[model samples]
Structures are given as C-alpha cells and as structure tokens.
Target: RDLNEYLFEPSKLVAKVTDIYLNFAEYDQFCSAVSNDGMSYNEQLFPQAIEVLERIRHPRERIDAFLKLGEHIKTIADQHKEDDVIYNDAPEEYIDQISSILMNDPVMLPSSRTILDRSTVIRLLLDNQIDPYTRDPLHMQ
Candidate 1:
C-alpha cells in the first residue's frame, strides 16, 4: 500500500508524524541517559521531515505546532547531553572501531563485516563511497 494514501489526510498525517517524532525523542532520551555521545537520530531526521512537511499543503498552524514541538524536543536533548557523563564501561565489541566510542546504534559493513556506529559510517560515506576498513565499494542498505 502506498503511504501517500494514508498521509493525504492532514489530521491523520500529522498524528502519524507526531507519533514517530515522539518515539525518536524517547529513544534519544534513553541514549542520553546512558552515554554522552553527542549523537541524536532525531536530529538527523528532523531536517528531512521538515522539508517534507513544507511541501505538503497542510494548515500553517499545524506545521507551526509541529515545529514548536520539535524545538522543545531538541532543547531537552541538548540539556540531557550537557548533563550526561561519559560512559567508559562499554565492552570492546560494543565500541565503534572508527570512533572509539560506545555504539548506541551499530551496523556492520557488508564487505568487511566490521561493526561501527551508524553515525560514524554515515559521516564516512559522505566523504567517500568506500568502506573505511576494506576500501571496498559500500552501499548502506
């Protein structure tokens, strides 16, 4: 089924998006409580979500309200990061090889089978299309 069908209704669409945003916010809070990694999956997706919302012909008030909520979530995330303590007790396998930090969201490189933090891999791929460890052509699935 095409998601566009369900998202055509502004009220339903807003509700779904808000639910997803809340879930991301909760996950970020959980991560912040455990580690001071300075990474947020919500932050990564906010711009994309905003761009999509801008293209939709939704009520201005709804968009504004969503933006306001997003800002509040970001503020809370920032505060959590500020007060978070560095976690140094992660097992070696749980650490990102590239960043040398605890991996909150880890992914394995298909070619090399090496595990690294999702954010680190994304940053690396932005600079080059090859895997850092194997220098092989990489595609993030």
Candidate 2:
C-alpha cells in the first residue's frame, strides 16, 4: 500500500504537468493569432521546464514524447525570431521583474504583489518555495 501510494503521487503530478504544458501551447497559439508574428513562450526558460519533467521516472514514454515535442517547438520558434523582431514594442510595465523580459504569462505574487513572468516564478519555486521578493511561503493554486 505504501509503495502504491508513492507511485500514485508521481502519476498525479505528471497529469498536472501535462495540463500546464497543453495550456501553454494553447496560449502560444492565441498569441500567434493576435500578433500575426512569432511571439511564443519564452524559449530561454523552456529547457529548465524540460529538465524538471525529465526527472519524473511510469509514463516514461509520455514524458519523453513531451520533451521531444518541446524541443521541436523551441527550434521552430528560434528560427522565427531570427527572421524577425518579436515583442520589441512591449511597454515597460509588461516586463517581468525577475527576467526583465517581456512577460508572456504574467503572474502576481500574493505576498509581495510583484508581477513576474509565469516561467520565472516556476523556475524560482522549483529551486525554493519562498517568494523571491517577500521571502514568504508561496502557495500555488
């Protein structure tokens, strides 16, 4: 029973990660449609997310597939950016506090009330649970 419970937790986590990945893809599609340009998720931080996913050890095939797809997407997006400028006209207010880049998916921290890119926050939280600005416990909902 203990072993079963332990295994079950990772499966649940995998499901959640998959959902987040799909949502990001949908959002990227929306951005592409509206901008008629190559704006997509921050390619710089994508590798970090993939590294996290690679650590998950059932569903090996599913995880591998995701990694493959993510790599392909990143490659294509990189090519597009090289051909044209992306988000060069973004306002200063739309920048992420941490990354200092144009925010693709901005999220507000409840404690510090600081706005940062979703990718930046996720990367920080993966290393530490505390909010970077306030140093308070961050509860992701």
Candidate 3:
C-alpha cells in the first residue's frame, strides 16, 4: 500500500528532508515529517535532525542544540568520561576553524558557551576537526 511504502522508506525521506534543510534551510520538513502520521520509521529522527540543523545558522540556536545533543550524548559519554568538560577540550588550532561561521553570523552562534572567537570555529572546519559540509543535524541530535 502507498501508506506502507511511505512508512518503510524512511531513509529516502530522510535524505530528501536533509537536502531541503541543508540547501534551502527550510523548516517545512518538520511539517511534512509530522504529516507522516508519526508511524513512519524516520518520523522522529527527521524532525529532530531539523531542530539540530536550524542551530547552525545562529549562535544562540547552535548552543541550545548542542546542549540538548550533549545531554543525549552524555548518556553514552558518561560511561567513559563523566566530567562535563571532557568533550569541551578543543585544541587551540581546532578552535580557529569555526570562526568564520561564528563571526559571519553572530545570531547563529549559541549563547551558552563562551563562544571562542570566530577564529576557533573556522579552524575547526578548516583543520578537519569539524566537517561542516558532511555534517548533518542528526549528528548533533
């Protein structure tokens, strides 16, 4: 049935959603995903990823997304490193990579973190610490 097909083909839908979110930076994907009736496999993951993706455009949003994600990742990380700052350690060089993303758009930056100079984000992206292109919102979520 067509409905079954929609529910089962979550991967394809996710790809489509990601393309729209990344290229156009639109939130309609959330609405469409919600239209899937909440029974689809990717239903939850798709919208959740969008929430994470939206943060990239603004600093404050980014912080909120990461903090939420960090909490989620913390469960697994706690098993290894219980301390909060364990993952916070970014080498000075790595810090420089994300700068462009930060300075270019202040609102896109998060409010929680100290927000190392824009240079830091730039370095992270340039040095390979952060893969800006390949990165998906789902990753942080």
Candidate 4:
C-alpha cells in the first residue's frame, strides 16, 4: 500500500488496491496509510483511499466521497493552472481544432467551448474579465 501510494497517481483503482493492502497488512503500515500527517506523503493519496473505502461503507457515504474526490481533483488542478499547462494527450485528430490560449496548443477548457491555452487566458483576464466567446464575466478569479 505504501509503495502504491508513492508510485501511482490517485485513481479509483489504485486507491482501492491501496486500501485493500493496507487493511491486509494490519500494522503500523495501516496507520501510516490513513494518517493525515507525513511530509513525504502525497496529501491527495489518503483522501482518495478513504473515498474508495467509503464506496463500501454505506449508501450516502458512497456517493459523497466519490463526488468529493472529483471536486478535490478539479480544485487542485485549477489552482495549478497558472503554474502548469495541462497537456492534452489525445490523438491529434481529437484536439486539432482546439487552439490553446498560450501557443495555440490544442487544449480545450472542460467547462466550456473555450479552446485557448493557460497563458492566453491569463493575458486576456488581465485586460478584460470576460470570456472571449460569450463575453460573460469570467468567474475564475
């Protein structure tokens, strides 16, 4: 479980496997897996593991944990948007029509039809707080 937590990116499959192994290990390692504090640990890993466990916990717990995981991942990604460009690994055909706001890279915004890259969005927001297409007030701030 510890190795999986360190190696794999947080996902439902990885999270579930880690949860199983940690419970199977049944020792300090299990404590380590669930503990919230550890400088070397990925903060997202524990919550992801807990959410995976919650799927079998109870009905309401099952629903909210997964939803919370999605929201958590999105929030973290949004926070990093300025510092990192989210790459689109889809085949060229899929993104060919999408123009990144930065170097016209092929990446589209998930929430809208906006296809601009991160840098372009920053520049545009600096000048005008409106979405390019709808002219709607950019609520990203």
lDDT agreement with native, every candidate: 0.67, 0.66, 0.41, 0.50
Q: Write the per-residue lDDT of candidate 1 for residues 52-86, one digit (tens) a residue.
A: 66676555665666676566666776766554344
Give one digit per residue, the lDDT tens place, for model 2 in 80-112: 566446665777889887777678799999999
Candidate with best TM-score: 2
List model 3 lDDT by residue over 18-125, tens digit each.
Answer: 554444333444433333233553334544655545544434554354344434433443433333255356454334244321232222223233344544444444
| Candidate 1, superposed: residue stretches over 4 Å from native | 1-86
TM-score comparison, 3 vs 4, better candidate: 4
**Ranking of predictions according to TM-score:** 2, 1, 4, 3
Let me know the TM-score candidate 3 reaches against the reference structure: 0.17
Best-performing candidate as measured by lDDT: 1
lDDT rank, highest first?
1, 2, 4, 3
List of clashing residue pairs for candidate 2:
none
Q: Listing every candidate in turn, what is its Cα RMSD in Å to the true structure after a full C-alpha superposition?
A: 10.4, 11.2, 18.2, 16.0
Q: Give one digit per residue, the lDDT tens place, for model 4 in 1-141.
A: 686767754455655565354344435434333332245445565565566556545346444544454445445545445333454444444342324222444444444665666655665669886776776676543
Model 2 residue 94 CA deviation in Å: 1.0
Q: Output the better candidate (1/3) by TM-score.
A: 1
